[model samples]
Target: MWAELKKGAAVAVWFMFLTLPIMVVKVNPIEQTVVWRWANLVWLGAAVFVLTVVGRYCSRHRTELSAFWPDAHPLLAHPQLKRFLLIVLALLATLFPLFFSSYQINIMTTALMYAVLGLGLNIVVGLAGLLDLGYVAFYAVGAYSYALLNYHFGLGFWAALPIGGLLAAIFGVLLGFPVLRLRGDYLAIVTLGFGEIIRLILENWNDFSFGPSGIAGIPRPGLFGLTLSVDDAIMYIYYLVLLLGLITIFVVNRLRDSRIGRAWIALREDEIACQAMGIDKTKTKLTAFALGASWAGMVGVLFAAKTTFVNPASFTFLESAIILSIVVLGGMGSTVGVVIGALVFILLPEYLRAFADYRMLLFGAIMVGVMVFRPQGIIGNPRRRSYPLPMAAADQEVGHE
Candidate 1:
């Protein structure tokens, strides 16, 4: 225990020392470039200290921490209560805009966007058991598809939405082809490289992509020649995202209950067994990638239309990381879990803007703590049944966690 505490403290110190400049420091050519602020150093020290203490404590009380939500466990197993809670949540979400201000509605819209992104990634990483680190590449593809189409061809948002998704689905196939046979870290590496490749291409190919300066004057979404005022526009985009999020949830649920979903689950659990059972691994993987990418593509259109701009910077590795984190944090295969995770992570930063500089620091701490104490995530996949075990085995599981 003493050795572990020392190691944890050393690791925390090393991380703060290394990433302080990169993550906590800021520089912008468009704004005040190369400006160094000393405030973050204090916050960094505090963050590191807190993380080290929490890490050491969690290491010791692993079992106690793992059983933190024992009361909620039985509730999760109850179908009627689960359905009731879901209905209440749906009602609250559907009527949110009416009770909130436009700004609040806009925030909810962003959360809903992340929810969709999280759901898409959940299908790939959660259900298919594939680790995709560069899923945002597909998001960039979708956004740029809409931007280029609307820019030169005079296409509307609705016209570009499906086209953009289709194009992204094609890209998904292309991405899967190169890394289809790879698994674990190898697949993650390729996907990460793929995302960087897409971003770099966009950054350099100024003629086609407009580079870092970005494409401006992109058209906002319109409904059949009905141009909404700014106030109405916020609500319009909010409802648009809300509708898409619902559709994504519904479709993914249907897919989860389908034969393909079962095949994907089998493949996830044991690829050798799945292949022996005559499951076509390649097609199953490609379909998973395509479906996930398609959702990202559709949401990409909504994003571009809402912002009315497109830039390579908008689709960075950080965006991909956050989306994937949401999926894993939310409990992968649980749609409700994804939504809750999205809202918590996305809005936590928003609400804690008073400590803006420490936002990422706090976020990182929360995620680390969760992983340390609750490895299965907040609302772990409901379908993954945990058979009651002997006390010895249960205690062992808790220790491992």
Candidate 2:
């Protein structure tokens, strides 16, 4: 009883530390805002105390609670039902723009964009076990490549999309080369520096990038003889991104089953052992980086086209962090997991817009809670096999005996 009480008290204190700023005190001096709403702190603290106690109970019973998903996995093996569910889901997605509010559709569009980014980043971090903080640099490279080519050279969105991807892939290879010998924190720091460097260059190079002022009036995408307009643009972009996201899913799923994918998984599991198995480390890593960046680059063009603007601010480290978080939270290397993570990360915040000021705090709290409860992730990688041999190999001992 005493231990539970102590734990509850501690949780209450922690929750107060996290939510206090948003719960009390308006600190925006620019609008001459200085108000203290301190009374609610007590109520909030008490509520947190009760919730924390209940959370402790849930944590202790997590295995029991989590059994439902394990149970459902067998049901998923029914092929016809699985296909039927998938078709239904796809049909729902196809009809989303027709039924949902424009605002929700816009949110889904953003989610799809992140899903693509997350899938790309998963190639490096999940499959290859790389820690790249400059992933957004490729995103920026793609966005800026399209923006500049379209702005200065009069290239259309369709024409510039592949070109942007190629440019980003080149940058990815360049990044991969310098960090070839690095790993873990060192690699992460280098990538972080690279991302910052890219942002700084975009911000400082006034003439080329137009500096902080940004490039505006970017042309929107269109079908032949149909220029996308404000009324239907979100829906069009939704379908566009949805198509891109599906292709990404298919490609990534295929790659995960391919020889290259096997090499990547081996590298991720044990680099030295993978090297001993004759996988070229440099080439493999570079390919992972290049492929991931290409996805981001392709989507970056759509991002630029969607917003009709490209600015250095849009490609900050925060963007990379968010994308990486989606990958991590979703279960790295799992395409469906990344998609779920993106939708959860993006849509949850939007749903909590009523508590706009506390959005980040809530996010932090939720992430902490998730990590504490599910260290692997919301959808972690599957358990590995106990033995890496065929049944024949296991049975060979009998013959020898």
Tens digit of per-residue lDDT, candidate 1, span 62-169: 668867675248776699998998899889988888889988988889999999999999999989998999999988888999899988999999899999899889
Task: Please give, for residues 30-78, the per-residue lDDT of candidate 2 as tens digits.
Answer: 8987888887788889998998888888768877988865522666669
How displaced is residue 55 in candidate 1, in Å?
5.8
How does candidate 2 score on lDDT? 0.87
- Per-model CA lDDT versus the true structure: 0.86, 0.87
* Clash count of each predicted structure: 0, 0
The parts of candidate 1 lying over 4 Å away from their true place are: 1-65, 76-80, 386-401
lDDT of 1 at 224: 79
Q: Which runs in model 2 stand beyond 4 Å of their true positions? A: 10-37, 69-72, 383-401
Q: After best superposition, candidate 1 residue 79: deviation in angstroms?
A: 4.5
